[model samples]
Target: MVKYSEVIWMLVLFFLPSQAWAQQKVPILIYHSIDEFQGQGSKELYVTPENFEKQMIYLRDHGFSLLTFEHWQDTSKVKKPIFLTFDDGYKNNMKVYSIFEKLKTDQFRPTATFFVISDFIGRSNRLSKAELKKLADSGMVSVQSHTATHPDLTKITNYKEELEGARDAIKSITGKPVIAVAYPYGSFNSKVMEEAKKYYSFGLSTTPQYYSENGLKNELFLLPRIYIKYSTSISDFEKIVNGG
Candidate 1:
C-alpha cells in the first residue's frame, strides 16, 4: 500500500507539466518607431536601433523564437515564442528589417508584423507602396492593416471602410492574405470585433499583458500586447519577454 502523501506527490508530478504548458504566456511586443528621439512625437514611442538590436540579441541568446501572425499556430510548438510588432507603417521601420537581417542565424530567424495604416501609405513619414512590397517579399515581415485611417474604432460608424477596406488595401499591396488588424489607438468594442470577424482572423490591442488562452469567446480577436518603449531598459525587456 502506498502512503497518501506519496500518492498526492505522484499526482502532482503527473499533472504539473501539462498544467504549466496550458498556462504558458506568450509575449506579443508592440513597437512604433525604431529610430532615436528627434523630439517630434511621443519619445516613448521610439526604440533606438542600437537598443532594439540589443533586445533582439537578448531574445536570440535566450532561445526565443520570433514569429509573425502567419505562424500563430506554432507559438505552442516553438521554444519561447514571441511576436515583434511595429505599428503605424513608419518609414523608419525599414531599420527593423536591417536589424533582423543582421541578427539572422542558423539557430535564430527574426521576423515581425508591421501593422500599416492603409490611407497613410506613401506619405512623407510613412512607408511607401514599394517599401511595403519589399518588406513583404523579404519573408521577414508580414504587413497587415492598422485601419484605413487611425481612428478610435469605438467612436467610428464606418466599420466596413476601416476594417474590411483596410484589409483589402493592404492585401492589394503585399499580395498576401491580410489576416490581422491592430486596433488604431488600441480601440475596439463588441461591435468592432463583430465587424472584424468578417475580415480578420486576429485582432490586436495594447492591453499591456502577455497572451494566454482563457477559453473566452472571440479571444483571438481580443489578443493582448505589451509595449516596448524607448525607455524600456534591457532588464525590463528581459522581464517583459520572460513573462515577469
Candidate 2:
C-alpha cells in the first residue's frame, strides 16, 4: 500500500543540503610541540619539524582548505575546511609558521590556532611575548586560551581565573579579541560549559573524531578534534583526515 508520510519523508531528505545526506566530516587536527624534542617528556606531544612539514604538504596536495578556529562562522565560503590546532604554546610552535611559509600556494593560505597557557608565557621552552606577537600578527596563526595555567576545567576552583583571565591576558598580548578556548586536559563539565559561554564564543574539546557543519549544529562548544601525535604515520594520518 502507498503511504503519504513515506513520500513526504523522501522529499524532505532529498531537498536537504548534501551535508545532511552525505554526513560531511571535517577533521580538526590537534598538535602540540613542533620540534625534535625527544627528551624526558610526553614524546607523543612532539612532532618533528620534518614530519610536520610533510603533513602540511600532504594536505596542500590533497586540496584540503586549512583554517583557524576563528573561521568557524565563515561556513558559507569554506570548502572542505580542515582545522590545524596546536596546544600549549611551545616555543617550537614557530616551526608551524615556518612550514606554512614554505607551503603557501595561490589557492591555499595556511592557517592554524595556537592554544596557549597564559601563565606560562615567556618561560623556558614556552612561547615568549615577542614570539606570540609575531605569530598573531602574521594573520595565519590564532593565539587562543588554554586556560591561565592549563588546569583541568572539571577540577578548577575558579572558572574566571582560568577561563576569562586567560582570555584577557592573551588579548592584552596579541591585541586581538580572544574568542575561543581549547579546554586544558580536554576536561569540561556542564558547569564548565555554562561558565565558558560567559567569555568565549567557541570552546574546543579534545574528543577524538571528525567535525562537520552538521555536527556543529549541536556540539559546537564540545567540538571534537583528532590528535596528531609523534607516532601518527602517513597512512593513519590519511584515515584521520578522511574521517575514518
Candidate 3:
C-alpha cells in the first residue's frame, strides 16, 4: 500500500513537469528608439519606423496581445500577453502611438510601456511632461520610471532620490500610480530590490530571457526582457515571440 507521503511525492513528480511544460512564457520585448539613425548611434538601439510597424502588424495578425506594464500583475487574464516596452522615452517614441492606432483591434489592442527618465523630461530629445501626459491619457501607453536621472541603481548613493523620486514625479505627471520600474542599463542588486519594493509593484531587467507567470513569484524584481535590435529579421521576431 502506498503511504500518503509516497502518494504526495508521486503527485508532485507528475504535476511539476506538466506545469513546467504547459507554463505560459510571456515575452517582454525591449526597444530603445523607433527611428532611423542618420549616423553615429548604436544600431542595436534603433529600430526603423517601417520595421516597427511591420512588427506590430505581425503581432496583430498572429493574434498576440500587446500588453501594458499594468497587465503584468495578472497574466492569468490573457492567453498570449506580450509586452512591448520602449526605454529612454525618446521623442520619436511618439511614432509608436501612431503605429498602435493603426493596429488597434477588439481582441488585440496594441499597448506599450515607456520607461522615461523623469529628470530628463523636456530636454532636447527626451519626451516633455505634456507629451508624457498625452501618451498616458490615451489608454494605450504607460509612463513608468527609468529613475530620476537614469543612473545605475546598484551604484547610486541616494536610493530615495533615484527610486522614489522618479516614481513620485511620473505619478504626479500621469496621475497614475507608478507601479513599475526598469533598471537603468539593467543594473540592480539586493539593495536596489529592497528599496524598489517600497515603491514599485514590478521591476524589469534586460536579461534577454522571457518571463512566465509560474516563475514570477520568486523573481518579480528581476523579471527578464528580450532585446529587440534593429537588425532582428521578421523570421527571428516570430521565433522570439513563439519562444524559439
In Å, residue 121's CA in model 3 sits off its true spot by: 0.5
Q: Pick the candidate with the highest TM-score.
A: 1
lDDT tens digits, residues 1-244, model 1? 9999999999999999887767879999999999989999899999999999999999989999999998999988999999999999999999999998998999999999999999999999999999999999999999999999999999989889998999999999989999999998888889989988999999999988889988899999999999999889999999899998
Off by over 4 Å in 1: 1-22
Q: Taking the tens digit of each residue's C-alpha lDDT, what string does model 3 give over 1-244?
A: 8999999999999999987678678898999999998676798899999999998888988888777767765566776779989999899999999988887878778889999999999999989999999999999999998999988898878989988999999999999879999999999888888889988988999999988665444388988999889899988999999996
Q: Sorted by lDDT, highest first, which candidate order results?
A: 1, 3, 2
Clashing pairs in 1: none
* Candidate 1 accuracy as TM-score: 0.95
Task: Write one digit per residue (lDDT tens) for candidate 2, span 116-165.
Answer: 99999999989999999999999989999999988889887799999999
> Which 10 consecutive positions of candidate 1 have the poorest summed lDDT?
16-25
Q: What lDDT does the true structure give each of the candidates?
A: 0.94, 0.87, 0.89
- TM-score per candidate, in order? 0.95, 0.89, 0.90
Q: What is the lDDT of residue 19 in candidate 2?
A: 44
Candidate 3: worst-modelled 10 consecutive residues by lDDT: 210-219
